[model samples]
Each structure stands twice: as structure tokens, then as C-alpha cells.
Target: QNTTSFGLTPCPKWNPNGTTIAGNSSGLKGNDTSSLDRPIGIFVDVSDNNALYVADHENSRLMKFNRSQHQDQGEAIVPSGIISAESVFLDREKSIYVAGGGKVMKVIVSGVGETILDGETEGEIGFHELSMTLYGIVVDSNDSLYISDGSYHRVVKWEKNSTNGTLIAGVTGEYGDDSTHLDFPHGIYVDFDYDALYVADINNNRIQRFHPIGNLTGETVAGGNGHGNGLGQF
Candidate 1:
């Protein structure tokens, strides 16, 4: 699910009225296991019959929806321990990773969750700290994790089995619309082939592409013309 192949041309038209495969069609919200509350992040497991995993934010849990069975109600896989789970990611090993409560946690299906990166813990890098206001989580092919720290206004890279994270994009604790900065970054994606990272600069209303190898500054690939209803706006 983490890997993506785009086949559409630029400015491709999409269906405005999309069908709802899971959750209430009427936009109803509930805390019940059958329903979801403030689901923030979703990952589709293509290998697992296209099963969808959602980070139920307000519910503080992870929900799994099986598309093969046409199930409307999602099963609570990780029921608790992740307060305000903002994002979820699944590695090739089938281990689930969650970002919430100022930490990144790893949980196996039907098992307890373990904190892999805690904000309170001192990072191995100099003066770098993981913030509680984490939004998106994605793992690269090398098993390293990339997370968007909303409060810190930057994206961090945590190597496998590493306690500290390296600042891959944006300045630490700084927010801006400049190429060298980011404002409340949300979702993140890694293009392994290009060796680049794409970040959803939420407040900046743009998508940025950053090369993690040697360059920290980002190039605006789309939507930097301010927020509006225009076709080029975001």
C-alpha cells in the first residue's frame, strides 16, 4: 500500500461523487466498533485482499476494514494504547506503526503496542526532539520511518532501531513558506526511485519535494499560489 504507481496524465479528471466502501454513507460519526470517529490516516493493504487500516483519531484505536468481504463495520485491531493516533503505516513485515501521543508505536495484530520513538526521550542527534503533534507516518524501502511533526514544523527520519531522528526537511521549530522551511507539515511520501521525499505542507497549501540525501531545502511542485477554489489552488 505504501508503494504507488501513477498512470494518470496531468490534470486528470476524477469522479466528484465517489462511492463509500466503508463507514457511514451519511457521514455519521460514532465511537462504536462498527463506526469511526475522526479517522485521520488510512492505508490499503494490497497484499491482504485490499484490507484498509484507519487511524481512528478520536477513538484512540486502529480499525481494519476488509473489502473482500464487503464489510461496512471495521474491526478494532489495536484497540487502545495509541491516544489520538494521527497516522498509521504498515511495513512489509506486516507490523503496524502508529504516530500519536508524541510518539511512534509499533504493534502487531493481536499484540500489545511498543513505543519505538518517544518525544520525551533524548534523540541521538544534536538538540533534535520528537514532538507530540505528529501527523503522518511513512516507512521507506530501507525500513526507516518518516514522520511529519506538526508542532515542530518539520519532517524527521528515524532509522531502523534508532532512538534519534535526523531532520530531513524544514528547520527545527521553524515554520515558513520559503523553500527552506515548512508550515505544519501533514502527510509525507517517499519516492525510492528518485530518492526524494514529498511533504504535504498543510498551512503553506503546497506540495514540496525534498532530496534527503544532500539537500534539505524543498522545491514546490504544486499548489503554492495561496488557498482558493481555483483549479491551480489548494
Candidate 2:
């Protein structure tokens, strides 16, 4: 299944790396110390001259790998919970973003992960308290960011340097049509080449595509009925 030693969801996707797609899922398990998590989610940092950063959240650290000489070689650059992280995200500048414990943190190369969108991001967006789970994040070329608020059952979009997210899809919990329907949405990806938006509607067992902007009122990418295998026609 997985070519790498392991795999992780909520992937730390890169900005269209050349060949390989580097990322990890999670190393989290229970409250106990032993059953804790493992290192998951690594990204190929071609932007940083082909480097790697692993969000080993459960073990409480981050791993940086040198891809030039050893593609698989790495070192834990930052310790876990150093940025109050649960998930890791890397921007174009090789800056890392981690979302965990109601916060999304940003980590610079020379410095640490300062809180970029957390307490204030929540307050401004009015999505903090209302939503229980927030996962599935994707960014366009310009810096526009989108996040899937699982608990509240909505997909929200926020332009860079903006505080609040404009609700663009699933504005209400009333699930009926393909456009305005989503439940427990997991992974969201944007096909920049086609200006298409792909969403892993987990609960719905399908993937949906929308225009560059959030307008889910059209045809579906995968379908509204069942899970997809990534090799079929619309």
C-alpha cells in the first residue's frame, strides 16, 4: 500500500514537488505514555532546496531531512509540542504550520512556530468554539487558505493576511443537493492546473470538486454516492 515505511493523513503536502510526494499521517494513539503516537507527516521541501520536515507530533518533535545526499536521511530539528502542534503544514517559504489543541501555529526556519491562526484566528472567524474538529487544509498559489471544519460540518475559506473565513460551502447543515451537502469532510485539495477543488467528503464516502472559488452547486468529481479509487471518469 504505502511505499514509505509508514503513512499519515492530514498530509503536509508540498507545493508541487518534482517527483515524490512526501508526507506522514499521525503517530497518536491514547492518553497513556506508552500507547502514545509516532512520527508522521513529512514534506519534500524543494522550496528549501529539497529538504524535509517531519511533524512527529506524538513523539513530541519535528524531523528535518536532507534530500540532496540522502533522500531518506533526516534529523529532528524541533521538539514536539514546541509549537503546540498536532498537525504540520509547510508553506511556499518552507515555513511550517501546525494545527492542534485549537490552534494553528507557524514555524520559521531559524526560529520557532509562532501562533499564526489560533486564539485570534478563532475569535475573528467565529469558528473556534462552534466547531469541535478542524482538519483538511489546502492553499492555492496566491496564499488563499481553506480549512474543513469537521465538527461544525462546513468548509471555510480565508484569504492570506485575513482573519475571518468566508463561508463558501455547506453553509448550513441541511444536506440534500450535491452542492450544499457535506458531512465530516476530511481532506481538501485544489487542482490549480484546472482551478478545480477536490474534497474528501469522508462521511459521504466521495470526493467533490468545485470551481476555484467555493461554489459546490455543480457536477461532482468522485461522486455523491460511494468511495472512489482515483482512476475513473466523471
Measured by lDDT, the strongest candidate is 1
My TM-score estimates for the predictions, one after another, are 0.90, 0.64
Per-residue lDDT over 1-234 for candidate 2, one digit per residue giving the tens place of the 0 to 100 score: 001233656755667745432332243353232233444444555656667665555566556666666443345555555543334557666566655455556668676656556533343336333253545566555666666666556777766677666765665444444566777665666566666666666677667777765675535666565555544521
Model 1 stretches with alpha carbons more than 4 Å out: 9-11, 109-112, 121-128, 212-214
List model 1 lDDT by residue over 97-206, tens digit each.
Answer: 98876777888765767877777545542424677677889886677888888878988888888867888898887889999999999998888778888999999999
Off by over 4 Å in 2: 1-42, 47-52, 57-61, 67-74, 82-86, 119-132, 172-177, 227-234
Q: How close is candidate 1 to the true structure, as a TM-score?
A: 0.90
The TM-score measured for candidate 2 stands at: 0.64
